[model samples]
Target: MNRLVQQMSSTPNRRRRPDPAAGEGSGAARGSNCKNITIMKLPRYGALSTRRDDVAMTTIRVHGWPVSTWTRTAAMTCIEKGAEYELVALDRFSPEHYALHPFGRMPVVEVGGLVLTETPAIACHLDECLGGPALQPEDLPTRTAMRRWMSICADYVFHDVVRAIPRGRPASAEELAVARTALERVESLVGDGPFLAGDGLTLADLFLAPQIANAREKAPEVLDGLGAIAAWAAGIEARESFRRTAYDPASV
Candidate 1:
């Protein structure tokens, strides 16, 4: 997983400081006691982080509805790793739902007092903790290729398929064209592989599966003739974690 850089920006204070107490002078002595008072406290979800002498088992708080595809992806990672976590379902899909994330989005994961917003980061952290049947490629080149395809899966495959949903049919002509171009690019990157990373299941497979599943259900015609992609999607969907976490409208 790519290490994210945390950047903090400063904003100028708009409020003016009140005049000092006439007798006490600046209220330094009076305000000193206020430091001891705890007004606002951090919200605790459940167990987070890894177990070590220095650190606690960080709580993986999933802040999204159970049915969302992104939430499913993150939850499936936790299941794959056998990591203990808590799911915090949020009703409002507004900016307030993602106060902890840099970009307001669902499925934000809070670990070791640090909030990770994207699915890839959260999945990577979980993979680190559990370390069984690791989801990432070991070599640098394969890892780079996986990350690139994973992004393609996110930005292209998922994007167009999701847009095709509300129409209650296959994607529009323009959307199909876009998906075709993206699929061709993805095929070139992943060429006739049983999985995106060649032989084994990795993050690329996990990320790509749901997008293909969505298209399969809503826009099967768009996916017709994509033999390799279809076979990979079938294998991923057959996994227990995927079956349990992925969206099923009938279950609702």
Candidate 2:
């Protein structure tokens, strides 16, 4: 929803479609960080929980719309680390965000004084710096394999699953055609182990989960027939990290 949400935010107000204000970004500061203090009265979409009663316990601040794939990916990374994040709902297309991210991607994360835009980098830093079960494998070969799958999730799975999704509708035939090879490759890989990398979950699974969920929501039949991905995603969907980051469909 990164580019699509930005496009809708830029559309003419006269259009019959609901305006981006439903995302409640209009009055948001054009270029400012959430001052270090916690401001939990969110003006836009509902907050993704960081599971702490005293929200200030975390320095993790995720500036993004809840429904955006990368945004949720960042949040999931923090959750899996057992670290809390303060979600600062901001307009993805704002010039300030473009300055921070250059590419203008959703969810510019500020944590421990570092700002990250790309999902993979954000996930890796959180996984390493924050404490929790290790998402990266210990063995050198498997770790390398884990990195390989993470790259595939970014370059290939992203195009087929998340980018292929059409707003307010399911994926079209052409989009599904583009998605076929990647989905099948995932199916073949899942048969090798319980995850994309190997026996246990890794950053590979965290990176792919939201994108796969996007495909399942928009083009479920493609996944249904590829029993392996369906089964694999089902396992991921059941995780506490995934559930904690999931946005309400109505917000989309």
Clash number for every model? Answer: 7, 1
- Candidate 1 positional error at 44, Å: 4.2
| Per-model CA lDDT versus the true structure | 0.57, 0.65
The CA-based lDDT of model 1 is what? 0.57
Top candidate by TM-score: 2
C-alpha RMSD values across all candidates: 13.9, 14.2
Per-residue lDDT for 80-105 in model 1, tens only? 77665688877555666646654566
Error of 1 at 141 (Å): 1.6
TM-scores of all predicted structures: 0.69, 0.74
What lDDT would candidate 2 get against the real structure? 0.65
Relative to the true structure, candidate 1 reaches a TM of 0.69
Worst 10 residues of 2 by lDDT: 22-31
Worst 10 residues of 1 by lDDT: 1-10
List model 2 lDDT by residue over 63-170, tens digit each: 898877778888887888788888998866788777666777777777654565566556655665566777766654455456656667777888776787676876
